[model samples]
Target chain A: MTVAIIHTGCANIFSVETALDRLGVPHILAEQPAEASGADRLILPGVGAARPAMEKLQSAGWDAALVAETRPLLGICLGMQLLFETSEEGGVECLGLLPGHVMAMAAFDGGRLPHMGWNRLHFEIADDPMLAGIDEGDHVYFVHGYAVPVTNHTVASSAHDMRFSAMVRRGSVMGCQFHPERSGKTGARILNNFLEFGA
Target chain B: MLAKRIIPCLDVRDGRVVKGVRFRNHEDVGDIVALAARYAGEGADELVFYDISASPDSRTVEPEWVKRVARAIDIPFCVAGGIRSTDDARTRLFAGADKISVNSPALADPDLINRLADEFGRQCIVVGIDSREIGGEWRVHSNTGDPGKTRTETRATLEWIEEAIERGAGEIVLNCMDQDGVREGYDIKQLTAARAVCRVPLIASGGAGAMAHFEEVFRQADVDGALAASVFHKQVIGIGELKAWLAQQSIEVRP
Candidate 1:
């Protein structure tokens, strides 16, 4: 039942930490890659640029360890972007845990660059454990410029300037472009589902 | 498409919530955490706690109070006021504020915006502008806490918005001093000037009297969010009822 939040040392992990705290879920802040193995699940949380984030991960040996994570793992926002092969943001390489590339959200269509605020979701699958009890049109808060392309792994999609993957999943690994922790009650449910469901 | 957001602002002074609200079933009516959580339950899209505390001592209480409120609610909340450096912004974020809103300090040192955006990402940095109509034009003014003399001097409003965006400001909050507390409505002319140059999301602040005012701002101005304090604080308008009303007006709002 132990959950570890991987601290990318890039963006503030306080919001994610606060969410877990409110849920009363026992968790640890895994600063180093080695610390991640002790937990039953790992949550990679981020919110800043990819290049410096990637460098931090590489320095902390998380780049190698993240690829080796056999436990159920979740990546949020910039954390989700880093799980991809490469990012158009600063032209940086990322952990190749998932397929497709990270491109500017505006590249899909010219809209607001950040694509921030709360938007509804259209779930690809009606019943995903990570999205358990969450409805098709439930609104979630988003705040990111770069996004992962809609691929086979995409479990849900949201439209801003154009349609983009809101949530992506590949086996034991899951990633959400929105801040589930900051999306109110529905977000709390998603996080709770993740804690209950195992690899 | 992103639904238009209705944000309730709380004024925190001397590390305590300034509004005294008596919600039924709650013993501590003045509890900031309780009040904030109620707003979140009432479908407030977001919350902003403007720190108006001017005391040099007891600085720790502000961040601690923010932590309590942020922990109590699941939605994003931003902290503004007296933040002059990257360290100050980082402290607030670490205390659980999702974003940092800066005003006068940013006007003084524009590079502080770039530094914060570089460290915390542009999404978390919000540049707050207090502007007033001076002479024949709308210009930016710093808050001086004086009603009669709110406008000390004028800076080019549109130019400042462009410069803030260039400095990596993720969002712009246009607080019209002319409309502030007047409740006439948002300064349409000033907002129009801001919309022309603002590339990021624009949040309209100051001068919201009733539901119609909110409706008018959304209809007239292409702003993303509308923020108000006393209306919500004094229970002049309930967040739930306001959102329902906005929804009925054909304005897309999160229910």
Candidate 2:
């Protein structure tokens, strides 16, 4: 399958690229609109504030191209956070692919900042291929402060401070709040499944 | 609920797994791949490969060795030490590690922690709290998970822990360097103290020497998991046997 990792300039391109390469698929990293439009799938990955992310996407015109892609597209971590309509991280507008807002993770004076490490993924829907060949109680990796509030579109959920969206999908667009590239074997399976259009 | 984890920490130097005491044991423990697989099938909840030396001499972990074990172990694994940059962390994850632990970096580049947590998510970040008892007070130590480095005093130490959480650190692995390998057991007081200060689940490291040491950690500190080395290396107890015992104690473990 033709997979394009949207290189709007801030995502962890190598990690995702390495994951796909390990899976034996040479992914086309979309640096320009023309390159992105040529793939069967588009992956949006990011690592910085939503403001810079959207700004770059606009300058590169990848955001418009992303909304146009009909093939299955996967967003990882910041990539997933970008799928929402807006994010409080710099108050930047997003792709509006999924209706929601991304804000800072909840914190009390004493609570830890930035949720990191392996946690359980609670499946809100059990019949998807994204987790195919993976176990029901598998531990997926996560690292984020802001998360989408569990909405009608959330396919899986996990609790940390509070229950939030773990994975969200609607038709061809899917996003994981965790980094599949860093999630070990379980992550690899998700990437492969994303490429194969389900596990 | 998911099962409790059993992790075996292997200190690496050059390209071999080495065991240490008080952070200085210096003995080869056979091939990392073989050792990892043995513990894995024996039901080790996870594996921790800590690069013991971070000096310029050992600038990076043997990536090929990392690749070997990433292919060897099927369960979750964490790579720590010398991981101060995105490229450093990226190399290990791409080579197959499940998570990356950083303490010095988390303290140094506050934004990197946030960026990583933001980019990767909390589950992939493991912040190490190398604590040492200073005049009966537990202090967070950086660049020394084994008590060799001096402690830095800063109000942000605690806030930094919180910042790590805010930026996306999901789990905190507290390595009680003071109690490490002392075997009397975990620095329950220190572990308890750190646990009380943070809402995130804690992984107790250092001073686990017996089967009961595991029990003491679980009973004393509300820890999610325990990491040990000597006992695992000497065959003093197997992960399976240890979990069986925990099961008898009514402690939940991954079967």
The candidate maximizing lDDT is: 1
Candidate 1's error at B102, in angstroms?
0.9
Off by over 4 Å in 2: A8-15, A47-49, A107-113, A131-136, A182-189, B1-5, B32-47, B56-79, B82-129, B139-172, B199-201, B234-255
Q: What's the CA error at residue B154 for candidate 1, in Å?
A: 3.8
**In model 1, what is the error at residue B66, expressed in angstroms?**
1.9
Runs in model 1 lying further than 4 Å from the true structure: B19-29, B54-61, B145-151
Report the poorest 10 consecutive residues by lDDT, candidate 2 chain B: B150-159
lDDT of 1 at B97: 87
Can you give the DockQ of every candidate in the order shown? 0.72, 0.16
User: TM-scores of all models?
Assistant: 0.94, 0.77
Error of 2 at B44 (Å): 5.3
User: Alpha carbon lDDT of residue B129, candidate 1?
Assistant: 86
lDDT of 2 by residue, A1-199 (tens): 6788887565356566666766888678777879766677878887646777788888888778778867898888888999999988778899998899887776322334455546677888777777677776677766567888898888888776677888888888999997777566777888877888842
